[model samples]
Target: MNESELIARYFAPLAGPAGLGLIDDAACLIPPPGCDLVLTADALVAGRHFFAEDPPDAIAAKTLGVNLSDLAAKGAEPLGYLLSLALPPDWTERFLDEFSRGLGEAAAAAGVALLGGDTVATSGPLTLSITALGAVPHGAMIRRSGARAGDLIYVTGTIGDAALGLSLRRREIAGGALPAWAKTLDAAELIDRYLRPRPRLALTPALRACARAAMDVSDGLIGDVRALMRASGVAAQLDLARLPLSAPARAALAADPALLESVVTGGDDYEIVCAVAPERAALFEQLADAAGVAVTRIGAAAAQESVLGPDGAARRFARDRFSHV
Candidate 1:
């Protein structure tokens, strides 16, 4: 099918009212009264972001879910999104069908609707990009620069699952060397964490009410935490032992403790990390619990410009996190 027919058949039903049935050249969006709009964009390209053989549905979810993650960190409620797709010559109609089905499901789950977008042919690889829009009460949007010295640092859910999952998918980890528990771990669960990340939208209200500063962990924890610190003009002291790990990850680490470095420094974790004042930490945890998201306090901010380790000593990593550069 051609581009127009492709959208009309597979994507039009996903459009919101503001999408104008995706017939117009542009979409129209209006924020609620006394609220400010929040916007974020993310892109995924095959071979670079996902394996070439990954499912189209998963690719669609990741493309949109990553953008939703940004809104969650900013304490915004999602409204709608625009998608742009670049199709490789080898792409089939079946691929588009599954891709749109997954995209539609993700949009519904996030309480957002499709706006409008573009599709084009590409000679390189399949590429998907999404620009998500959300809203927050006026002047209430959380920021990465609001963290203060002495504020406690917290992360939602566990970390490093996606990173390790990617390693497994890429065959970088020797499956035979893993512990029995690790070997028995369901491959689908680990890989699903990598492919279909659950954005912490449920925690947005709590973050708006309690977090001093927040950002989603797209890059590795170590690098993203440092980014937060630098943005807030503060340093942090993290306890490596305190970094939350999933059971599979824990089992893998038990087999090889050195995997801790990979766990801490790898990326693609869509969890949220935030700074909260020491006094407000308890309330924040309570609110997050009510939202059904598990949180853990891993460190605190300081006036220095360094990240310390569990030994209360400053340490350096050969590579802190993933960099597109």
Candidate 2:
């Protein structure tokens, strides 16, 4: 079908009044009184972001969830999102149907409406981008520069699950043989973590109430921590032992300790990492418990550079981060 027919049949229903039924060339948004607008955008490309055979629903979830993760880290509530989709010449109706359904369901669950965007045909790979809009109280948006000396570094959810999950997924995608350790771990769970990223939106309340600085862990945890610390103009020492790891991750690490480096540097984890003043620790924990999200105290931010390992001094790590050049 053509873009107009596709929009009217599959996407128009997803739009809010601000989108003007996608009939208008532009979207109009009015933020809540006394609130500031928060905007974030992310893109996903075929083969790079997800396997071609992966479920359309999972792709939609991750495409939008990654953007929402940024808003959550900033302690903002999603207002709406603009979606741009580029489909290859041979794109199928089934893919479009499933993808739109997944995207609609995710937007509804997040209380975000669809704004107007462009849809076009592409000769290259299928691609999608979302520019999400959120609202936070004026001057209250969390940033990566507010942390102070002596602040405790805290992270939401387990680290390295998505990274390990991605590795497991690669093996499956390439039809490679799984190693002995792979048989012992929860492969399904790890793959799910990689495919469906859970943005820590529930923890925003506590974060806004207590966190000094915040950012999402889309990159490796160690790398993200370093980024946050650099932004705050402070050095930090993370306790490798205190990193919260999922059962599968722990089992994988136990089988081969070398996987520890991959776990630390492999990206794709959408969890939130933040700095909390020592005095606000109790309140933060209380709020997190109320929200049903587990948070772990990983380390402290100060003017130092001595990380501690599980059994001794910090173990030397290779490539603390991964990035696309």
**Per-candidate TM vs. native?**
0.94, 0.97
Cα lDDT tens digits, model 1, 164-254, are 7887776633334533435866655677889888999999988988998999999899999999988999987787667788888877777
Stretches of candidate 2 exceeding 4 Å from the true structure:
none
lDDT of 2: 0.89
After best superposition, candidate 2 residue 89: deviation in angstroms? 2.3
Using TM-score as the measure, which candidate wins? 2
- Which residue pairs show backbone clashes in model 1? none
lDDT digits (tens) for residues 9-107 of candidate 2? 878988998999998889998779999999999999888887777898899889999999999999999999999999888788898789889889888
Relative to the true structure, candidate 2 reaches a TM of 0.97
| lDDT, model 2, position 67 | 97
Residue-pair clashes per candidate: 0, 0
Whole-model lDDT per candidate? 0.87, 0.89
**How far off is residue 147 in model 1, in Å?**
0.7
RMSD of 1: 2.3
